[model samples]
Target: MDSTEVAKQENIQRMTSNENTAIVIDNENDAKFLMKATEMQLEKISLGKLAQQKGNSAEVKAFGKMMEDEHNASLTEIRTLAQSKSISIPTTVSEDSKDHYDDLNEETDNDFGKSYSKMMVDQHEDAIDLYEDAIEDTEDPKIKAWATKKLATLRTHLERAKQFKDKNDNLNS
Candidate 1:
């Protein structure tokens, strides 16, 4: 081939390689997001159930019920999406979240409601941040849409958690 033709062929090959690399990177990101999201959901469900059983306050128990139900629904949706994408989600919660669960399990009844409420506030805030980051980082349309859909619920959970925390604090004061 002539020098100009060789240069053209090399450029085409480079572009093709770059395109393949981009696809791989995008798939990796999608899998990571799915795994993280599933872990968070499982943790929320675990904590929420604990609160429902151990909470002293009616409001806290109600909030826990809400969290359990809603998080379960979100989990189902994400699992379906992950299956369609051929991604494997972890069946267990993350270690960090497991630590939180263990700590909450050790709380006394007098402290359980307040402690659980505060944890919910923190967890929901973290979840909102995670979803927001995923929405920004993901190139997949399905993942972006799932994150966007879940953001509204996460925000609502955060708001409710904060309200419960404030109310519990006021009661203690």
Candidate 2:
């Protein structure tokens, strides 16, 4: 082929490759977001239930109940979104989360309230960051919207967790 024709063919190939790459990246991003969100939800639910059953303080139990309820709703929303996208969510909690659960389970009742409250503070902060990242990174309008909505709730949860931690600290002092 002539030089001009060869150059044109190369440009076309590059464009096609870029388009394919974009699709693959989008799919990978969607999958990662869905899986991470699902795992977070499961961890929250499991830990929250544990707190509800074993917490020494009324406040801790209430916080745990709130976590369970909110995370369950969030889970349902994300599951629907994943289904629409044809993504499969894992049914089990991650091993890292399981280890945390085991650690919490080992704590005595007197210590459990403080330990669980502190965990809630840390986990909620992590969750808020994750949702914020999702809102910024997701190309899908539906996922972005969902993340935006969830960000506010995650912030609220974090604020509540911090309040609990501060209250516990004050009680200790």
Candidate 3:
């Protein structure tokens, strides 16, 4: 590889490893929060698109569309924040996320909606926890503010997912 490419790779490694002292985000926890948030966003986008195409129910499809749209917007905000902080975020979902998606994909159409709703409920709950932790733990005001701002929306999503899961379960039963 060219010297420039090598230098770039090294920089990315330092940033990702939280070893770069020159970066705006100096705290390891802040960096971890940003990276984890990015991964969640990517996974949501992937699963959302799948639901859009594979969901058997209107509610599932609509929820998927909401995930796609809202997460896409959130991702843009995250990207801008990461860029400003000189942090590198993942461009794609992780292998585990892909595996989860693949497993969800194997569900039959009749069960897909119920399974997807359950997944959403679970994911949103996890996301709420993450955001809540970030809001409490981040020392950087920008990161803290971002997390705080997103918390309510995440809560709303969680409630919606719960409602959907309940309705989906009732219908399935």
Candidate 4:
């Protein structure tokens, strides 16, 4: 079957787990969350690279280029942290991240920039939620600490993305 079908089946199994379901939160779960986030960040960087290569304007191209640099660096940092804990991160990009940007590939020029900025804003918001929920609910110290820090970053990125969107809009108008 297709990936969507596989994902649905996985979700069903995840929801039906006999053990109590807990997110990767707190200090212990930090390793897992970092690995997962790294996967996502890497994909974001990939999208950014694509945007830079084919973007229509200077702003759009710069935005994509910057994301590639920043996200790749962020991924490196998180991966390093995970290594300290002997965690093995996945080598492949996440299906969710791929799907998120795959739909945006058709956009071009100013539209692509605006869309990307909005996407970054939305993604950061979701990341903040995930981090906050896990940090608040998990008993694991490692997960909590990591989530707390990550939440802070997500919030900052969300604001930055919104500002980028506003600037792009103003310039276009």
- Predicted model with the maximum lDDT: 3
Per-residue lDDT over 87-131 for candidate 3, one digit per residue giving the tens place of the 0 to 100 score: 666777777788989998998676888888899999999999999
lDDT of 1 by residue, 1-173 (tens): 33223433443454456658777677667777877788888888999898888888788789889989999999999889988976667666767777899999888665887788888888888888889999999989999998999999899889989998888766652
Off by over 4 Å in 4: 1-32, 137-143, 169-173
Model 2 stretches astray by more than 4 angstroms: 1-19
What lDDT does each candidate get? 0.81, 0.80, 0.83, 0.67
In the range 1-173, model 4's lDDT, one tens digit per residue, is 44334433544454455355454223335544555576667777877887787777777678778778877877776667666755555555667767866877877767777777787777777677767777766676665676677677677778878888887666562
Candidates 1 and 2 compared by TM-score, better number = 2
Cα lDDT over the full model 3: 0.83
Query: For each candidate, how many residue pairs have backbone atoms clashing (under 3 Å)?
Result: 0, 0, 0, 10
TM-score-sorted candidate list, best first = 3, 2, 1, 4
TM-score of 2: 0.85
TM-score of each: 0.84, 0.85, 0.86, 0.69
lDDT of 1: 0.81
Quantify how close model 3 is to the true structure by its C-alpha RMSD in Å. Answer: 4.5
lDDT for position 96 in model 2: 81
